[model samples]
Target: MALPITDHIVAAVSKMVDDSQVEGYREPSHSDIEFYVSRAGLTDADPKAQGQTVGKAKRVRAILSWAIDNDQTAGGKLVESLIAKVRASGGFRDSSANFIGADVIARAVEAFDSEGYILSSDGALRPKNLESLMGRELTVALRDYARRAQKGSEDAALLSGTSKDLLEATAAHVIRTKYGSYPQQANFPALLGQAFIALEMATPEDPPSSTESPYRVMERGMYQSAVGVNRLRNKEGSGHGRPWVASLGVVEAEAAIELAGVIAGYMLDKLDNR
Candidate 1:
């Protein structure tokens, strides 16, 4: 069976196929004969069975010699050279979209829809189908790109390379600048845990970064909100309530966590505070 990679195919591909476009196919096309020998290669003809057709030309070099011997234009002859170029190899053989005698190849390319594979508002060949693919295969390419980018974000979120030791550190910076310290507690792990959650909750397009648990715009913005905030939350209440203060005791940063106090006022008893 004919495969995409073959010496003859390579030779034929070399003659007309734009070397830059074909990725990694190179062959010597010195004259008309070389061109013919190479052009004959584009078909699915078997090297052994088709040997009789281009007879005794065994290799691409031998085929070129034969073309020079019998044909004046070498073996470059084809029913429609341009259309043939598109069938055997994608891309335009010549500057013109028209192929010999018919526009079969060009028309087929133009037939595709924009998203499905249009002729391209600019006259570039778009891969309409996976019949032939060079370079990166587009079959699962877009999806793979998404996965790779997502994986990168997850890694960055895990890094914890920030100044603040709390979730949404970036937001904390802004909020701290305005409100002294963010309402977030100075706890390390709890804030970091929230940061991780923030990063995970982030859309694939944008992720949260920082030391604190990125719960909102802070999570969606920069800063998981704090360092180890996520770990602190997970260590205790699955990641729900007040920021855990990782210290000798609990000390609020610049501002007090009135919410924690509020909950304490409601669910948490005064004895529990002790």
Candidate 2:
């Protein structure tokens, strides 16, 4: 069977980055597709690829694309971390000569996410239907490494997939501008010179944000045990940073980013009225 959708995205991104290099481009370190590979499968190469020097990173992206097409509920960094572990293990052992590399296992994880949680008792990054967008991105990022590897090479196949995706995205955007009603935000992340500084707990030593925002308690406490007063401190303590949150595509955690935005907006409206 083909891989999932998240994997496909990874493949496309990887290709894009790979092809970019041929244009005498120097992509940023974080932008390098390889940074995402360990999560989207495609760890080691097969006997043919191993010796023949096929791009392992490209293969990883290919596998990742397969996963994305098949799965959407998956997302976030936690799951990415798990896929990373599997890739580090040198792929999985199979009964037949056809070894199930990180790519194959990643596909399985998508299925597991689609079905429900697929973790072992040890809580390792096994299958789980509790899809998280964070996990999905994590997968895409890893799978893309393969494309990066290809772009690094002089092969025609390098970045072939990525070029197609960019063209598609551009075309789609044009069409949307001409026909669509709901317009996209001109600035996607923070606009202009805005920067996002990260803050978090200091582990066993520091404990500042344990009760900062009573509002967060109402927001994250659902589908979770950490609610009420506990959420407040952390909310304010993070120096007003966007608090770390989880996704729900993993069949667990219940947070619609858009919905959250809507609610916040409504509250803001009410405050203004008052």
Candidate 3:
């Protein structure tokens, strides 16, 4: 399914595209438009020949619309680029020549926030959808782990630990939702199995039969991956107080984080759908 693009984002981009009538508005040059179009990898027609305000707005809308329908990631990147440009320009001025940069920024920020992203101070975008899917507390912990893991001194152990926490939190959320509370003393695999059981979905223990559906096969694989994430955390993660550091690099750590995110998202999605 195609991911959503908010109306506010489209409006904000349209405003930036043709704000010449505004009192202190600085119109983007032809080169500027071309640059943006090129950066977004849009290849419909010449942006310059797209005509005046109305025509330009239509072109922008069409590009964004097509992007969302065809490739949602590209669509998201395009929106991110537009928002960054608007922020960089400090926004356009109103008819009274009042600086309304803050208002524009607020609208853009709010739009992204609703979509589960944090536009950081340095303009870097980070996903925070877990907050909405799981809860704010779990999301907060995940974000902290992400931030620490991505620091200049990247800690593989910490990243590994975060991956485990990601699944733990997800499983805990599922079990708690179904049974009022999860077993605190349960091990990682047990907790994860309980989550799948609570959701009435297949777990790692569910053996593949000749007549098993493809979905069950996929579910079994996913459960195994969750267990693997836990195993990695136990061996290389920070909580063990290991005497020697594991021979894991940033790339491995990043992969672990990404894997954890995908699994967690899948689990949470199942929870929501069920």
lDDT winner among the candidates?
Answer: 3
How does candidate 1 fare on TM-score?
Answer: 0.20
Residue lDDT tens for model 3, 1-274: 1235666566655654555445544534445655676776764533444554344456666667666566556666566665556545544333323233455545655766776655443333445443334454554444444443335223322323233366677788788777777798899889999988887778767776899788887888778887876666644434446412366555765666566666666676677677
lDDT of 2 by residue, 1-274 (tens): 1123344335423432232223333222222233443343433322223444334345445444444454333322313443443334333344322223344455554444554433221113322221232223323322232232223211111112232111112222222323442123433121100111011111122223667665444333321221221122222332233222322142221222222223323222322333
TM-score of each: 0.20, 0.22, 0.44
By TM-score, rank the candidates, best first. 3, 2, 1
The ten-residue window of minimal lDDT in model 2 covers 190-199
Give the lDDT of residue 249 in candidate 2: 40
Q: Arrange candidates, best lDDT first.
A: 3, 1, 2
Number of the top TM-score candidate: 3
lDDT of each: 0.31, 0.30, 0.58
Number of clashes recorded per candidate = 43, 58, 0
Error of 2 at 41 (Å): 4.3
Is candidate 1 or 3 superior in TM-score?
3
The model with the greater TM-score, 1 or 2, is 2
**Candidate 1: stretches off by over 4 Å:** 1-49, 52-108, 111-274
